[model samples]
Target: MTVWDRPEPPARPVPLDRERIVAAAVALADEGGLEAVSLRKVAARLEAGPMRLYGYIAVKEELLDLMVDEVYAEILPEERAGDWRAALGGLAHRTRRAALRHPWLADLLGGRPALGPNGLAVTEATLAALDGLADVDTVMRAVETVSAYFTGAIRREVAELRAERVSGLSKREWQRASGPHVTAMLATGRFPALARAVHDGADGDPEVSFTTGLDWVLDAVATRLTRASP
Candidate 1:
């Protein structure tokens, strides 16, 4: 056929890269949790052969790591004008908000080392906030301590959100009346303090609860830094 008569070469398929692959994987996970994401599925999403993804990611775990780092891009905060406490607290709040937006992230947070470029940037930001506050070892511990607190707190908050969704009950309502079992256990008086706290304590807003606890943790870190300083 003459060049003019030839069907325009079928449009070349869009090239697949790690970014597109990770994006497809993340969309799949967002729609259906981590279990929903597979290389084959990602490849299918991209309209490419499953093997096409292997060059970019050999296994699902690597894809998950990439997905986690992808979300970290959202978790990274804008510049702040306050001290280290404000910086770290801002980071923690951003992270919590990110996890809430992407609930699947709760499953992977702290499950493995975050060594990706974005992940390292997040770590660097956290450490940089406290860089001159104390010596290297103390600062490292402080970062770890704060990290551990928020990681566990975010996981629990996400868990509660899931549970609430399933039960169609707010956390306080769920605790007070999910079943007679909780009430019966508390009524037994074997856990008087627990019962009293449950009955007397106000179940305040979740964000407030999170912020208060984070402030407490930041305070502890501040104390450590002060003591460690010359």
Candidate 2:
């Protein structure tokens, strides 16, 4: 057959792997949130048939697990913090930063066990940081408490950030924009503490607030450890 007539070599299928699948899933999630992600959608983004992704990820849930683990890879610290307090604090901040970058993550963070290697590493680091600081049950509780705190906090932060984006108002501005309502409420005198807070401008910098609360929680964990010690 003439060169033109010869059947063209089949284009090699774009290499498919778990990493690429997860990356595509993350991109979709970043752009449209977790609910926007699906196996077919991710496959379309990767320019592959949905079936191709099945080889890499068994189901949509597995893809989500991979996406979360990928973020954990970013959250992992390069060097261990000097102490348990520092270690836990560093992880919390890193997690917050990650959630900010991928706000959709708040929906999945701590929603399910990671099971992936990177997720396992993050858990290991957290647990190891508290090793020898307390008994097994106490350490587990401390880890759970810290994780629960940060996950919930990050979700709130992201929600507020999105609200501000939609309303085009910062938190303080939103509160003040309701001045008429607030003023009327204050006149009622029933919400005295809240009225005083509004008048006093009780809201502090969000970052400062977050850090301060985190430190308090860490201190509580320390108290638990101290109580558990010999």
Candidate 3:
């Protein structure tokens, strides 16, 4: 009766593969977001009953883990082009795009649940992107710092996006939500600095803040790498 509705399976059992099952779940998550993904829903999408899915994916949590890794697989496992700065910058932007595309991906990936093959490959690519750093310690430190910045930035953007979707309000509206409380306090002029800050519209762009932070972090690493004698 519907476009996405699959035909009911025949009475006989249909063979199920774990990979195929996971793929279906991933597609469901991509289309409907995480909450719409469930054993029953995945089965329905695959044109089978809920009971049919468990033969491959034991539980919903397991299904989620698979779905999360599946998205991770989208990133290629190779060195990014150009020098370290451009390489790592590309890595950060690509990561943010991946998380935004999948929506549920940032939280699950950041939590570092078991790294499926795809997850390992992506991490390795990120590490390789740090080429030219002198020692193992420096390399590892750079990897962790860039990764922390990239993932943290992705998470914040995801939250902001969700807020924008639900409230139909831009970031300015979000700031305005605190406006009344801020205004009443300013009536007494007790906090001159705070008042001046608010009046100046000094909130600044979060996107630029993330980029600047990433650059500063890399700068510190470069400093350490340079200071250490070969």
Candidate 4:
């Protein structure tokens, strides 16, 4: 048969689409954390060639941006229900949990808040979450402060995880390893308060340590924001 006369094959559906490729990358991250989410690994998981993934994600950083935003989508915003304290506090907790659950997310928030759909959604949700909280400037400051604080806390926690990953140390073991530093600092009179804090804080519940500081910040901000509002 002539080439033109041969039966035309059905058009092949598009593969390696952005959404599917991004989704596969996200799944790889979720299953094995950020370290396991390389493009090659994701392609392997999707049964596609690594080059195919490049059609969707330009580079690993873009993939990370996509992943970061995807995880941000998981953070449900807190609503203003006549209790600003409850609202902001809940927002802080939710964002913190999202960062902890997907630890790489904490790293992303360190950079500027991107303007992608998921990133914009998070920014909008956060702003919307602060509805009627006084003037826009105050609201902006409050949101910025909360965002910075939560990101810092999550970063610290993730740093601990990364540090321990090398030695495979348990929480107690980490503290033990750092005990000499604490003792040395306490032995010096320069940081009495910090030494006391570390000594006292060690016995506290990990959740309490993570959640309370943000609550305190939000509490102060909410009160100040309410006072500043007309």
Candidate 5:
């Protein structure tokens, strides 16, 4: 058959790009966690052959990096009219919320340097907040410290949430009555401080705990900035 005479070559599949591919992978991760995301699965979701994905992403790790940067777009914050503390704290809270929405994010947080556009924007905004407050080294150290704090805290919180889903118990419940073994251990008087805190400590809201800890860290940052100031 001639070129125009036979079905017009059946049309091309919908154009595939990195955005669509990353989106499909993110959707799969949202539904079934990170393990569910793979190049083949993403290609399947796009209704394209797996090999077709290579043009956009070279490997699964590259796709994962793109996925992380994509989520960083959600964590990006608007310009706030406040001090550095407000700026940094807002970024931390937004990041925590984003991780909660995309639980798989906890696994990837801090696993690699975020060098993509959105990720760099986040780092830029963070550094910009304290730009004039301290020397370059001090500022770098402050950012690293704050980033470390939130990264670890968010990971732990996500882990606890997963544990709760699996065990059908809240954190407070698990700590206060974590089976007979925990109860027996606590009763042994060798762990007086631990037992007292577990029994008497209130199960404060997680957000509140996160906020409080962030504030403490930010306060420390503020002190360092003050010291570094003229």
Candidate 6:
């Protein structure tokens, strides 16, 4: 066939779907943080128009919900731990891992209800772990309390990690840098506790710090659960 007469091959369909769109959005976020992700950028990455994404995701909020749930899928334990403490601990650690893997998740954690299937399943698994251990209210409180601890902890940890990276110094080193008001403030007798922590307290590894805090929270929850059970 002549060049103009040649049969035009059919146009390839842009395989637009929720999963693909979400994956693109996640990749964008992983590279440049959540604020970097947008329908236009995601669509561009997929070689489709922004409007095409709306069919799968009504708005950016829905996209964020999907992203958070996607991380929840990672947080779910492969097998339920034998006991409630183990189960909650496993879930909390897994969640921390997920947030570390996708720091953007820290921004969304607990910001909204997790109504997606995977997110709901995570809740179900968490509740199941505490089942029969306490009254419904106590069990609910235990879950919320532990969740609140980890979510806030992870956000703080990620913030510190970002700051450390930007400053090119570990947290302890940053605190130890002499002069510039911080040292002067520490020298003031009014802040004895703060000065002691900065000079004498060990700056533990982040993971160790996270696990220690988690264990403390779990211990508190255990007391409540035990009191309420049987």
TM-score on alpha carbons, each prediction:
0.88, 0.90, 0.77, 0.78, 0.90, 0.89
Better by TM-score, candidate 5 or 3:
5
The TM-score between candidate 1 and the true structure equals: 0.88
List per-prediction Cα lDDT, in the order shown: 0.81, 0.82, 0.72, 0.72, 0.85, 0.83
lDDT of 2 by residue, 1-230 (tens): 22112333333468676667788889988988888899999889888888766655666766677788889898888887788888899999999999989998898887767776777888888888888987899989998888888988988889999899899998879978998887997898899888777778656777788898898899898888999975
* Candidate 6: tens digits of C-alpha lDDT, residues 1-230: 21112333333487666777788888899888998999899999999987767656667887787788777899888988899999889988999999899988888887767877788888888899888887888898898899899999999999988888889998768766744687777777889988888679886888999999999999998888777888
Two-way lDDT contest, 2 vs 6, winner: 6
Clashing pairs in 3: none
Please identify model 1 stretches exceeding 4 Å from their true place: 1-14, 168-179
lDDT by residue for model 3 (92-201), tens = 76777788788888767556534666767766666666655577777777767777888888888888988898899988887789789889999788999888888985
Ranking by lDDT: 5, 6, 2, 1, 3, 4
Model 4 lDDT tens row, 1-230: 32112333232243555566678877777666778888899889878777766655667877787777677677756444355565556666777788777776766776866656766766676677667768888888887788788778888887777778878997789889989987887898899888778767557665788788887887788688869988
**46, model 1: CA deviation in Å?**
1.7
Between prediction 2 and prediction 4, the one with superior TM-score is: 2
- For all predictions, the C-alpha RMSD in Å is 7.7, 7.8, 6.4, 7.6, 6.9, 8.0
lDDT string, candidate 5, 46-161, tens digits: 99988877766776888888899999999887775277887788889999999999999999987777878899898888888788888999989988889899999999999989
What's the true lDDT of residue 59 in model 1?
Answer: 68
User: Which residue pairs does candidate 6 place in steric collision?
Assistant: none
Question: Which residue pairs show backbone clashes in model 4?
Answer: none
Candidate 3 residues lying further than 4 Å off, grouped into runs, are: 1-16, 77-79, 176-178, 190-193, 201-206
Clash list (residue pairs), candidate 5: none
* True lDDT of residue 169, candidate 1: 92
